[model samples]
Target chain A: MHVTEDDLLKFALETCDDAEAQAIGEHVAACDECRERLALLRRDIAIIAGVQPEAERIPLPFRSYRPSVWRAAMRMAAVLLVGFVGGLAVSRWVCRCPVTVVPQYGASAARAIAASPQAVTPAPPVDLAATSQ
Target chain B: MVYPKGTYEVSDDWRDLDQARHGDEAAWRRLMERHLSRLVALALMMTGSPEFAQDAAQEAFVRLLKANPAPEQGTLRGYLTTIVYHLALKENRRSARQQNVENSSLEDDSPSALESMVRSEREWLVVGAIRALDDAQRTALVLRFYGEHTYEEIAALTGVPLGTVKSRLFYAVKQCREWLKEKGVFKECM
Candidate 1:
C-alpha cells in the first residue's frame, strides 16, 4: 500500500506510534515515492527548526507596576457607585407601595369617591358586620 | 521540545506564574529569564525584524505582568508565545504600511541582484516562505515547530479548534514544501 502524505507528515512530526512508524519506515524503504516525500518533509521541518530568533538580554527585575492607591480607590468607588445605583433601582421596582385609598375611607365609599368627580372628605371606616352583609 | 529539560530549576510554570501574579519579584524574574528567548524567537519569526521582535517580547511580558487572572490553561511559555504572536502581527502590519509608503515614492522598488542573492540563501528562503504565509498558517507552524507544541497544546494556546490547528499545519507545511521545491532546495537525498 502507498504510504499517504498524512502518514508521512505524522511520522515526520513523530506523532505516530512506534508500530505505525515502523510500518511506514518499512514501506518507505521500498517505495521511492514515499521516501522522497518523507525526505522533503524532514528537510522542511529541519529548516523551521533551524530558525534562531536573536535573544535580547532582559535585565532582571521586570519593571511592572501594581495598581496605585489612587487607582485602586477609584476602582472601588466606581464599584460602590454602581452597586448603590443598582440597588436603589431594584428596590424601587420590586418594593413599590400599592396605590390604594387612605385607611380612614371604607372600601365602598373610597370606590364611590374615586368614581365621582366631586371633592368630599373621606368616609369613616364601615363596621365589619355591615361590610360583610 | 523548545524548552530543554533542566533549563528551568522549577519545572511547573504555573506555580511560578501564580507567584508572579501575587507580586513575587523573584518568581516574575524566573519566568522572564526562562521564556524570554522563546518569546523573542516567536516574534522574530513572525515579524522578521530583531527590533520589533525585542519590542514584542518586552510588551508581552509587560502585558503578562498586568494581566489580571493570568492565563490559566496551557504552559506559561505557550501563553507568552500567543501574546508575542499577536504583537508581532500588529508590528508586521505597521511595518508593511511604512514599507508601502516608501516603495510608492521610489521609482525602482525591486530587489537588486545582490539583495536577491543574499535572500536566496537557504535560511533566507525559508524565512521568506514562512513570512509569506497567512497569519493563521504562520502562527500554527511556529507553534508546532518553534514552540514545539503538540497539536492539542497549540489549539488550546491559540484558542483554535484542534481540527483547525491540524488544517492550518497541513496547508502551512504544504505551502512551505512547494515554495522550497520551486527554489530548488528540495532534493531526493534524505
Candidate 2:
C-alpha cells in the first residue's frame, strides 16, 4: 500500500506500533517520495522537541491572590472617616450664633414694656424736665 | 496509561499532592518544580507569550491548591496542564477582545525591533512557527509533543472525540512544517 502523510507523521512521532513502524520503515526504504516526506516530518519533529524546557522557579508560597483583608478594612475605615469629618463640618456650620439689635416699639407698646417686670431699663427721671427747661 | 510504567518517576506524586493540599511546604515545592516548566511550556505554546504563560501556569497551581476534592492521582500533571490551557485560552480571548476594542494588535504579534533582531535563532524560529498555528492545532500539538500525552489522553483533556484530536495533531504538525519551510528554517530538509 502507498504510504500517506499521516502514516509518515505517525511513524516519525513513534506513535505507531512497532509492526506498523517496521512496515512503514520498509516501505520508506523502497519509496523515494515517502522517504522525502518522512525526512521532512522528522525535521519538524526535531524542532518541536528541541524547545527549551527550562522555566523560572515558581514563586515561593503560592500566592493565593485573594483580596487582602487589611485592604478591605482600610476601605471601610476611609468611608467612616469621611463621614465623620463631613458630619462635624455640617454641625459646626449649623450651630453658629450672631448678635442683632432689637427694633424700638410705638407709644402704647412702650407703656406695656414699662409695665412689664422683665423690662429693667428705667427711664431717666428728669429727661422730660430737662427738655422743658 | 498510568504514566507509561517507567517513562517518568511519579511514584510519590499522589502522596505529594496530598501533602501539598494539606499545607506541606516541601511537597508543594517539589510538585511545582516537577511540573512548572512543562506547564509553562504548554501555556507558552497555547498563548504565545512567555509572561502570559507563566501567569497562567501560576494561576493553575493556585487553582489546583484551592480545588475541593483535589484531582485524582496519576493525573495531576494532566489536570494542571488542562487548567493552564483553559486559563491561557481565556487570557488570549480577553486580550483579543481588548485589542479589537482599541484597534490594536495583540502584544504577541507586535514584537519590538530588538525582538525582531533575534528572530534568526533556531529556537525562536521554531517557537514563532508554533505560535502561528490556530488555538486548536497548537493545543493538540503541544500536548502531544511537550506534554508527551497520547491522542486519547489529549482527547480526554480537551473534552473532544478521539478522532478530532488525531486530526488536530496531524494538521498542526503539517502546518508547522509548512511554516518552517516558508521561513527557510527547514528548506534543506524538505
Candidate 3:
C-alpha cells in the first residue's frame, strides 16, 4: 500500500487518533521518505511552538490601573455636567424675555386699552340724544 | 484593619461575577484581580503586542462590567476570552490597515525594519512563521496553545464548527512543525 504525502502530513500533525498515528508511526520508522517528511514536520512545529511569545505578567487589578477612578468619575461627571448645563440653558430660554421687547409690547397694549373707553368701563352709553333726535 | 461584612471573604468567581452584576464593585474588583493576568496573556497572544493586549484586556473588562453578567451560564474565562478575542481582532484589523498604509508609503522593498528588530533569532523565525499562517489557523493555534482554551471553548468563541476547529488545529500544528523543520530547530531538538 502506498501512503501519499497528505496522509503522512496529516498523521504527522496528529490529526489521527491512537490507531492511525500508530500505523503511520510504524510505517514512517520503516520508510525513509516518510521518516524525512515526519522529521521536517516535527522541526516546523517545534519552530512555531518556540516562536510563541513568553508568558506575560498577569495584569494588575483594574482598580490598580492608574487614573481609572478619576477617568470613570470624569466621564460620569462630564455626562452629568452636560445634562445640568443643558437643562439650565433650556430653562433660561423658556423663562426670560428681552426687557426692551416686553416693555414695547406692554406699552402698545396699555395704550390700546386706554384708547378704548369700553375697555375701562363695563359698557359705554349709546348716544341717547342722537337716537331721540 | 476592620473588614466590612462580605468584603473580605473570597467567594467563587461566578458568585462574584453575579454580585458584581448586581452592583457589587468590590466583587467586580476581586474578579478582575483574580483573572486579569490570564486575560492579559490571552489578549497579548491574540494581538501579538503587549500594549494592544493591555488595551484589549481592559476594554474586555469594561464591556464585561457593562454587560448583564451571567456567570452561571458560562465560565468567566470563556466570557473574558471571547471578549478579548473580538477586541484583539478589531485592534489587529486597525493596525493591519495602518501597517498597510505605512508599507505603501515606504519605498524600500526589502524585508521590513520592524521585522528585523525582534532581537532573538529563534523568536524572529517563529514570528515570521506564525505570520505566514492564515488568520483562522493562527488564531486557533494561539487560543489553543497559548491561551490554553479547550477545543469546545474555542469552537464556541470562534463560532467555527467543531470539526473545522479540530481541522484548523491539526493543520496549524502541521504548518508549525514544517516551518520549524525548515529552520533546523527540530533537528537540534532531536
Candidate 4:
C-alpha cells in the first residue's frame, strides 16, 4: 500500500527519525506517485511557513503609531475653522437680503390688516346724531 | 519563511554577547530589541492571548538569563525562540486545563461568524485557519515553520519523541492546507 499522508508529510519536512526516514525515502524512491506527493507536501510546508506568525512581526515604524496630540488638535482646529467659515457665510447671506414676505397671496400668506388702503372694507353709516337726540 | 533558513543572521548577536554577559544593560537591551518581537510572535502563536504571549516571551528571555548561567552556544535567536516557545506552550496547557469549559464552548462543531469572516485577505484567512488548529498542532506547526528547527531539535525542545513531533507536524500542515483550500485562499491569493 502507499504511504499514509502523515508519513508523506513528515518525510517531506525531514522530521522522520533515522529508520522512518530511510524507510520512507526508499519507498519514495521506488514510487513516482509518492515522490510527487512529497513534492507537493514540501510546497505546502513552505506555504505554511510563509504565513507563520513571526512573519508579521517586521518592525514597522508606524505600527504602534497614534496620531500626535498636536495633529489631533490641528484636525479639530481645522474642523472648527471650516464650521466657523460656513456659519459666517450663511449669516452674511441671510443678513444681506431676507426673503420677501408677500402677505396677501402667492407662496407665503397672512391675514391682511387695515394698515393697507386696499385692506379697508366699506360698511353702512348709521344716523349717530339722530339716535343721540 | 519569516525566519530565514539556518541560524538567523544577527551579526551583533555574538558581538554584543560579551558585553551582555558582563552585566551591560545596554547590550542586553540591544539583544532584546533585536529579538523581542519575533519571540512575542512565536509566543502569541502558542498562547493565543496577547497578554499571556507577551509575558511568556519576556519571561523566557529573563529565564534564559537567570536560569542558564552558561547558556547554550548557538544563535541567540534560536535560544530565545526555544525558550519563548516552551514558556508559551506551558501557559497554553495550564490555561487549557483551567478553562476547559470556556474552551469547549469555543470549539463548536460549526464555524462561528467570526471564524468565517476571513474573506479576500490572505493574511486574515491564514490566521483564521491557524487559529482553527488545536494547541498541540499549532505549536508543532509554529515551531517547525517559524522556529525553523529540525526534527531532532523540535523533538528535543518539546521533550516529545521524534515520532510524536513528526506526526504532529504532519497533521498540522495537513489541516492547515485543508483549511486554506476550503477558504479558496490558494486560488484567490496565490
**TM-score of each model, paired residue for residue:** 0.54, 0.59, 0.48, 0.52
TM-score of chain B of 1: 0.60
Cα lDDT tens digits, model 1, A1-133, are 7888778877776656689989998999999988887777776677755655445555434334654577789999999999999999997665454333446767887789878878577566555444433
- What is the DockQ (computed on Cα atoms) for candidate 1? 0.13
Q: Per-candidate DockQ versus the true complex?
A: 0.13, 0.12, 0.11, 0.07
Which parts of model 1 have CA positions greater than 4 angstroms off?
A1-6, A14-40, A62-133, B1-34, B65-73, B92-121, B156-160
Per-candidate clashes, comma-separated = 0, 0, 12, 0
Chain A superposition TM-score per model: 0.40, 0.38, 0.36, 0.37
Which has the better lDDT: candidate 1, or candidate 4?
1
Q: Mind giving the per-residue lDDT tens digits that candidate 3 earns over B1-190?
A: 0111123333387777666655567877677666565566556545556566566777777776656457455666667777888888887777744333223222221234323324466665565455556778878876765455677777887899877887997777667557656886455322
Output the lDDT of residue A109, model 3.
75
- Clashes in model 4: which pairs? none
Q: What 10-residue stretch in candidate 4 chain B is worst by lDDT?
A: B109-118
> What is the alpha-carbon lDDT of model 3 when measured against the actual structure?
0.61
Residue-wise C-alpha lDDT for candidate 4, range B52-113, written one tens digit per residue = 55576677666555443333477666777878876765776677344332253324322343
Q: Of the pair 2 and 3, which is ahead by TM-score?
A: 2
Which residue ranges in model 4 land beyond 4 Å of their true spot?
A1-8, A17-40, A52-133, B1-12, B19-34, B62-75, B93-120, B188-190
> Which stretch of 10 consecutive residues in model 2 chain A shows the poorest summed lDDT?
A124-133
Taking the tens digit of each residue's C-alpha lDDT, what string does model 4 give over A20-133?
A: 889998998999988877777666666566542221222222212322577679999999999999999997766655344332443322244445557644344544444444
The candidate 3 chain B region of ten consecutive residues with least summed lDDT is B1-10
Residue range A82-113, candidate 2, lDDT tens digits = 99999999966654533333555789988988
